[model samples]
Target: MSLLDACGAGSSSPATAGGGTTAVLNMPFLEDMQVPDPDIMYEGEGVQVMHAVYDGLAQYKPGTNEPVPLLAESWEISTDQLTYTFKLRPNVKFHDGTIADAASWVAGFKRRAAINQGPAYMVAGIKEAVAKDPTTLVVHLKTPNNAFLHYLACPWHPFAVSPTAVRKHAVGGDLAQKWLQTHDAGTGAYTIKEFVPGNYYLLEKFPGYWGGDVAYDQIRITITPSVSTQELQLQQGQFDVITKGLPIPDVLKYQKNPDYEVPVTLGGTGNAIWINPNKPMFADRKLRQALVQAIDRTPVVQTSYGGLVPVQKGFWIDKLFPPNLDPISDTFDTAPLQALVAKLPDKNVDLAWGADGGAPVQQMAELVQTQLAAVGLNVTVRQLPTAQVFDLANQPQAKRPDLFIDWLGGDALHLDTVLRIMLRTGAKPLNLFSFTYPELDKLMDEAILQPTTDKMNAMYVEATKFVMDQAIFVPLCSQPFPIIARNYLTGIVQDSDLPEVIYADKIGRKLS
Candidate 1:
């Protein structure tokens, strides 16, 4: 994805209300988000909520866009690349007045790894976790995993977990996952004061926070449906800060006005329509290539992003991904691209196009239909429920659908988030969304267990090639962070890589 400085929103939205000091920005789609507990959050939206009222061993800095130590002060990894020792910060207490120790962290992780117990079972890639000392935590790997650090930064990992409260709450049935689906227990800077599902949540700073002090004393987060509601509420002075989901160009027009501050934070949240290769029609490389060439990305980029973000290059970080993203890098190799599209066997293809029952998705689906049809392949745009998109992608072979239109992203934990969701065979389908390819697994193993620089690149290359060969997911575009905040909402730092809610500790009010 192109950096934020490169893409530009057409204009910023105007602010409303008598007290412009009380900024209200909007994020529509919170109703689809369910953050029942610290462990179980509504994917990306959950990350925002987790940032405000929760703390992990490592915390993200909104301004610097870095993850600093929150619970764990310092740590070490063996040169052999197997044993990882983590030393916890002492005297950290949860809102419930329970002290967090190494054992607590270990137990918390183990419980999280339980079947459906924690949202991060994927993070527990290895077989086991152990706490050797009160201040130290160790994870023995069945194989060396260098990307584990990135996994640790994930909100669902050990950093935000609390063992004592989790275990106590999880006595009868499988409690950890259940507790996480309902409760919040962590040693973060803030604690949940009140939680009314589908309504709003209030958070108060934790006085016992080991860190000097949190800048914000209170955080008020209310749920808003639809993107328009987020914008409407913010305009009405009902919000302090909001993120523009996927950067609709019309939304950016507000930035043209000087009344409200419109900051474009270069976030890692990318927007792309991933095509599943497992489908019989996508099974043909020709059809896949034809499809890529068929759909003109210009309209989506112009209409959806308003010329702010750029067309995405590859799956991983733009340059961080293998193959230098040189200027001509965006150019498509039509030979291979075309050859794949022509090779598809005559068969019915159902590309899972969950058209939000809207014109854009429907239009895009029509374009794709026409493009593939040109190559003598029949394409069925199966309009499905949004929720089934990911499930179908991750479903097992027999039950899986032919294709899915989906978006996956990464922040500081770029490789982990992308690779795990894209490759990690351990997930439901064994190969994430893509059906398993042996060569793909070998390369991933080399990157994970072998740990060689050149080999790592080779694996990524091989993996991308494998993805291209299968035509599983076709890349589309990236999204930019459009932020709106109040004047008194000082210390508001938006980390492009992480979520917006991390500002909980840094946010403060300035009474003029």
Candidate 2:
């Protein structure tokens, strides 16, 4: 299939350019705009900007999940799969006009490791990145990591940054974190023209882009935090595309217009309510199972999400790597759950979540509260902004909520990422739930080090079943990213791997 076909982009809407030159995208909320640096960002909105402003050693091909040549012209893996050698594309230059060579990449990798921030785990396995020669970059791994390429292809990893730029901006060996928070460093399709945290940002096409011509000369990203406001702006012809965060009802309303197409695809983290087993309330397996059994996902999917999203019965890993070994049954039975509830001395519990997932999470949490209450359990829902929720999650065990309704979307397509980052005992500090499952931890370690895909798949399958049996978290649904694009827009490709990010490099207007 062609790239557009792979991206699922050919709709029947009549084509005509609304804006003569600029293509505008509207996002409901931005976690922050400190996007010039990749190490600190955890949100997918940051990834969207990274896709436009930086070039990785390798990247997933546009519209597909397969890794293709990006900064590296070609690459070879060692027989043991512990070593990688990449051949850099010749004549590439960073936005600062410095040559991007093997040494450039080596400097970036070392700097990223030193900073040891949010995405450092991606390259943490790398023992060293050496400059064998001007065009040759060699990487030595601590172990055989099956997901190495997928990690590099993810936006969270360290992309090629100009060594000269970093040196010039450094103060007290800070690695230019302050300057890069709002500046450009790599060779990408677009350059940062303007950035203003939560308000809006503008990007201009870089004529010197090594890949090729970028479709949009300028991309203006406006932060419209209200679903209603974004829908109105889209209708008023102010936005060429309304990005994710539009409520499902608003998305459904816009689908009726032949002038627009709301493309919905499975993306981001699978939605779930995390149970801190450390808490006394959720300490019992039966009690945790009871909470899961009480939730009827039918209304949450149909009424809240308008059926745009699918019910996620299996772990998110099942969506990508699956024979779906031991998929968690979605069958709801409240009898055992009620019996367990009767045994508890205190039935009052707190359900914490954010308003970030749009209307679906809010409605689901409310519905869960009402349903659980029907079974003679008192549930209190605590709502917080996205940042504050994360803050609470990182707090001490005593202060954390009983449960947090959120999604733990691995940044890449590998099961190792999902297992190690989210499921492995003591892995997720952000969630602040210190869980100790020695056997499960051993299984996860073996899964990542397994040299073969078949063996790796088997281990991950067993791990998924173990996690579900424990009822550590209640799996909800796989998030469906909704995009409303103007009918005239062509070359709109959503990355199959990084579905949260939308590519504008190939986006252009269609002639009627």
Candidate 3:
């Protein structure tokens, strides 16, 4: 099959020339130079890159988007979906020439759960990672987690285990998280060679890989902090594979180019303006509505953002949802603004944006202020320092934010990441939003506490609606992610949802 056919075409953007194997990326956060154990990868991008380097018990087939067997020959889950048993591919071998064994898998699982933060909490319910003799590993969960198998397919699992590898470079928190950074213990297609944090990362094809040989000999991921520089590199033939983040217009340069081809994908993340419900001013939906309605998205998107489509729904707004339509640009609609002003506290609104000082937020704050003032609302905009923003965003339930903006892509390998983190009325340990609505919180409680998938999905829809109605956040447009790459890079997936993980697949590059 043709590489384009293999990747499957989409509406967002077109694909590049060459096969979908090789890739070049301008990774901004070059601070992460090591591929930490898949079981312990805290960052989403880290886990993405680790996908190609490490094999999970299950894998997502590139074009088909189906989760199929990889290291594990087959697996079984209880009807409750709480327990999972895997039958390993007995012939697989690690990079160091050791057999991939059940003991190694169990050891990695324990180490992952012991780590304090990130998605490892998914396995908190895992009662056991018992090795049934040698080829079998059975995991028993404390609860019937429907997302267990999917979570296992994530970087957190087919756990990266190294009998001696992780222990060698283990640091700070734990041994497993540290060692996998520079070492290879898994039977993956690629191996790490040079890692200079914040500068660049280099990976080489491993002949010892158990799965199959990759066509590319080397992959270099340089940290091009500037998005403009990345766009230039792709057009200038200096790079291959560009990830989305730039405006649609900025990407047009490459998209129209006949020398090579370029494509864009809608990565699976939803970006929104985070509002702290605890703040007295934002506490009122009227004030929140005013802010959302007042800002002019046209200038903001056309000028600041390149070509990202606008979204009105706070979360999961369907294709049919309206107000923001395609081809026709979005302007600051005043009808909703008038409706909001009528419901306000009858006073002028003064607000502060808690985040690093930026023109975008500053402009947004000013725009909101101007719109409200025309209708007798007073507005004040404050830009807090980055540290203060972080502190406030992470503040305990007792002290929560009034207005803040952030990006939260849908991620719950356990599938509950969204429900458990955002909609908690109850005391969920990881309630980042700290929003407590009797009805909303109760819905979340039911969703997480429920035993069946049917019930779980139903409750999730209800809870999501609650969040939307509450407008705990001001819905903004999702920024477009555009990638540009030079020819010779082939077999690259460039998945929009999780770009970091997509580049990690063993890409093929034909050197001239």
Best by TM-score: 2
Off by over 4 Å in 1: 1-29, 59-68, 116-132, 215-217, 319-386, 393-403, 410-412, 424-426, 429-434
Ranked candidates, highest lDDT first? 2, 1, 3
By lDDT, who's the top model here?
2
Give the runs in model 2 whose Cα sits over 4 Å from its true position: 1-35, 61-65
| Candidate 1 per-residue lDDT over residues 1-512, each given as its tens digit | 22211221111122221243322222333444465565445345556557655666764444343456667887788888877788888877876787787787766665556544325544466656677877888877767886676556555545556666766787576655565554578776767777666677666677888665865555666666465666555555555467544235534666774435667665554545555556555555666655555555655545555666676655554523532621113544335444564554555656555433233344445565665565555767766544455355456655655655544454344444565555655543223355556676666667766566666666667667666665555565554566675444556666536444445566554443
lDDT of 3 by residue, 1-512 (tens): 33432332211112432356343333333233334556545444355446556776875544232456778889998777667888988867776767778887887777666664555665677888899967898888886766566565544454556656666666764764555655556667766676666677676666877766665555566766455776555444445555544545555765776544465554444445566666555677766655555666555444444444554333442211222221222345666667666666755443565332233445555655565577666655666543344344366644454444444433433335555545555433334456677887566556665677567767766665666567666555543444555444556675433543554444554443
lDDT of 2 at 333: 81
- Please state the error at residue 215 of candidate 3 in Å: 2.1
Question: Which residues of candidate 3, in runs, are more than 4 Å off?
Answer: 1-40, 44-48, 61-66, 155-158, 168-173, 176-185, 289-314, 317-402, 413-415, 423-433, 436-442, 448-453, 476-480, 503-506, 510-512
Candidate 1 weakest lDDT stretch, 10 residues = 4-13
TM-score for candidate 3, please give it. Answer: 0.75
* Better model by lDDT: candidate 2 vs candidate 3: 2
What lDDT does candidate 3 reach at residue 28? 38
In candidate 2, what residue range of length 10 has the lowest lDDT sum? 8-17
